[model samples]
Target chain A: MESRNLFMRMLMHAVIIIMVLIWVVPTLGILISSIRPASDVLNTGWWTVFKSPLEVTQFTVENYESIIERAGMGTAFRNSVIIASVGTLLPVTTAAFAAFGFSRLNFWGKRFLFGIIIGLIVVPLQMTFIPVLRVYHQVGLSGTFLGVWLAHTAYGLPFAVFMLHNFFSALPRDLFEAAYIDGASLLSVFFRIALPLSVPALASLIIFQFLWVWNDLLVSLIYLGGTRDVAPLTVRLASLVGSYGQDWHLLTAAAFISIVVPVVVFIGLQKYFVRGILAGSVKS
Target chain B: MAGVTLENVTKRFGDVVAVKEATLEVPDQDFLVLVGPSGCGKTTTLRMVAGLEDITEGKIKIGEKVVNDLPPKDRDIAMVFQNYALYPHMNVFNNMGFGLKLRKIPRDEITKRVKEAAKLLGIENLLDRKPAQLSGGQRQRVALGRAIVRNPQVFLMDEPLSNLDAKLRVQMRAELSKLHDRLKTTIIYVTHDQTEAMTMGDKIVVQNEGVIQQVAPPLTLYNEPENMFVAGFIGSPAMNFIKVKLRREDEDFFVDGADLNLKLSSALLDKRPGIKEYANQDVIMGIRPEDLGDAQVEKEFQVSDDNSFTADVEVVEPLGSEISLYFKIGDISGIARVDADSKARVGDKIKLACNTEKIHLFDRETEEAIK
Candidate 1:
């Protein structure tokens, strides 16, 4: 029996190693290609640099320079930051309050309202594009940052509410009751106890919402319009790889720049992400 | 400190009644314990008093005011949950001072009260440490300190010692009693452990199926249990029950069961004239293990002349000063407590004597104590 268990462990390790290589190799290639000069990148495979240390002299920062200065990448980067920050902030704050009400407060039709919210999670985002665009146009919000913010906030609400409500519901009921007995009103308990204790869940949700909005293209293009000054990195990067699709160097640099914020955010909040995900699920 | 009264308190969840019309008066400065098996609504009763749970159909009064519609904060009560419910994010001082701060007490006063509570609980050094950093016993002390800092009119605790280890539970039990004495505050504690109920409570309310079985001082509840439930619940190893028939042998009445017979005491017989109604009917005979002694002592008393029963010892458990002998008499198996020096062994024949005055008689059908 022990031999069988050991055999299973060995097989699992092999599968995991293979999966990690599959995900890591291409991203490593893009990073190496983005650093190397366009001539050397097109000439030799990125693997050759690992075998010869002297070959690293072929590396250049020109691809990054052109992407940032000539392609208006700086403006797109700022636009992406604005949209993603607002997108994450608005949804998460609203969701926290709404989720608390769904989980803790006693109200008429609470279960039914929560059921409708959960049901919304399964609805495809593509189905709401036209109807939401029409509303944005009627409300004089089209072609503005507020328009894209509203669009992303609407798209993010269902999942945000679902995740946070499940988390809020899992907290020990005794803790809330203790706060209530300690002379805290419902709003006070929410701000003082529930919100503070839910840092981990909030951190993870911030990472998720920030990443999704950062990498978004369709919603930004549709709501904020294809204006060069207002378009996010995703839209600008898509235009860089236009009909000819030949600027691999510029594409790689721009993509890497776009990926940096989320990676940094993930690394910063990783501890809380792991803890918040499991806090209310188990005793430990 | 103030007393709490629950009059006709009933709590229901859908179709199930959790606390059924419980009426209790917890006097000021008294340590009252509500004890029962799990699902007996002991915790529910405590929560209702804390206003954590709403009473379905009843009125609750704390210190002369009807507080049925008041929130827990307005009720001026402090509670220690079974899990301690210490705020994990806060240090011991902050957790204890949180209530005072919420009440908008001045900063210096809050600090003083928190420090005083910490000193009283002997957790002053742990004031800066979070609950997660503290051991189970330390966390329980912090919980108590949190309650004390509030200086509320009443204190409610729900199985506060249950999460601790056996040795820690015993240690904490004494500390809690001492804390109660020093504070002199009305406290309503709940536990499933009968030992806690017997040891800590000035007045113990024994409950079963959401109904109060009996409520009295610890000794009164132990010595004069109102029903079979109270009798069986109060004692360790439990009181033994035997099915017996009340039989009239000439002018005297006797209890006749399988492999045993006992002459009824005249005082017991006279006190319960209802036994005449069951002259030849089945009855329950209850006897605590300690009530039985060595047969040699039985010769002096005529009332115990018919109390001798022969049995084979199935097991002998030596517990320091006393030995518990698990023995069998025909089809009936029971335990008897004897001196530790007794030479009783498994499979050995022994004759035991019963204390006639300590025997309890109950009607078989109703299970109510006859005397």
Candidate 2:
């Protein structure tokens, strides 16, 4: 019996190792390809660099320097940061409160209203693009950061509320009841108990929304009108790739630069997700 | 500091009534326990009093004001749930102080009150730790300390010790009783454990199926249950109930039941002369196991042919101090808790003496005590 159990554990470990390698190998290739000199990258395979892993002459920062200084990705980088931060913050804050209200409070049409909001997750994003674009044009929000942020928030809200509402509602009902009986107002209960314990759920959500907004090309392209001035890195990068598809060396540098923020956010929030934030709030 | 009055309070969830017309006046500084089996509306009644559940039909008064429509926060009560419900993010100090902080009390006062409560609960060393870092017993103390810091008008606890291990539960039971004595505050506690109710409560309300079965002190509830349900529920092993016919002859009263005929003691007749009216009618006789003894063992109660019943012992469960003799008189089964020295064994025909003065009779039809 112990041998059978050990065999099963070893099998699971092998399968997981294979899965991790499948995901990580491509990203590792990208890192190596980004740093190699453009001439060497286009000629030799990326794996060839591992033959002499410590050689410094084959690697150079010129590709990155060229993309940031010459291609105007610098401005796009700044724009993406602003757009993603506001986009992530606005929807997350609104959704957290809405989710809390949906979970805890009583009001007329509450379930019906929540159903309508959640039902939006099933609707295709393509169907609403034209109508939302027309609204943006009339409101003079076209080609602006605000236009894209609102669009991201609107597109992202239903899923955010869906995820957060489930998390908040699943929290021990007794904890909230205890707080109310302890003489806390609703806001106090939310800020003190619900919000704090929801950090793990909220962290995963931040990682999710931040990545979505950062990587988005279609929404920013449509709402920001494909203009270079207010366009984020995704829009600008797509345009650069279109205009100069052969500039793989600079594109590699741009791709790596674009991914830096999300990796940091994931790593920072990773610890929160690991710990059991609801521990000791109820029976262990 | 204040009493809570519930006047015909009824709670309904759509069509299913959870608590029906529960009327109780919990006096100031009294520890009143609402106890019953699960889903018996004991917790529902406590929730209604805490203003967590809205009273659908009647009014609730906390002190002099009707608080039927008040939110839980405005009701000015502190509750410790079965689950500790400690805030996961806060350290012990903050978990205890959060309520005071919400009331905009001065920082120093909040600190003092939380620290004082921590000291009282012997959790001062744990004030820096989060609840998740503590053991189950410590978490319970943190929950208790959270309530104590508020010093609310009333304390409502819903099986706070039910989560602890048996030994810890027993210890916490004594500590809670001590806390009540020290605080002298009105507390409406809810638990399904009759032992907790009997050991701690100044008054106990036994509920079953959203209806109050009986409300009295522990001894009174045990010795003089209002109904068969209360009589059966309050005792540990439960009272043995047998159907018997009452007979009256001149000035004496007797009950004829299953191979045994016992004359009602004159003392019981004086206490409940209503037995005279039950003559020739069948009644339910309830006898606690402890009220019976081995006829061979020397005891205070008299032993005679009229009071002793011969039965075949089926099982003998012997504890160090006493023994439980399970036996059958004809087809009626009963248990007799007798002296440890009794020689009663399995399959032995042993005589058991029942203390007739301690027996209880109920009208079989109504199932209520024949007072």
The candidate scoring highest on DockQ is 2
Interface RMSD of 1: 0.7
Candidate 1 clash pair list? none
Error of 1 at B157 (Å): 0.7
In the range A237-267, model 2's lDDT, one tens digit per residue, is 8888987699777888888889889989888
lDDT of 1 by residue, B154-202 (tens): 9999999999999999999999999999899999999999999999999
Q: Looking at the true structure's interface, with contacts defined as alpha carbon pairs within 8 Å between chains A and B, what fraction does model 1 recover?
A: 0.77
| Segments in model 1 whose C-alpha atoms lie over 4 Å from true places | A1-62, B249-251, B267-281, B296-304
The clash count of every prediction, one per candidate, is 0, 0
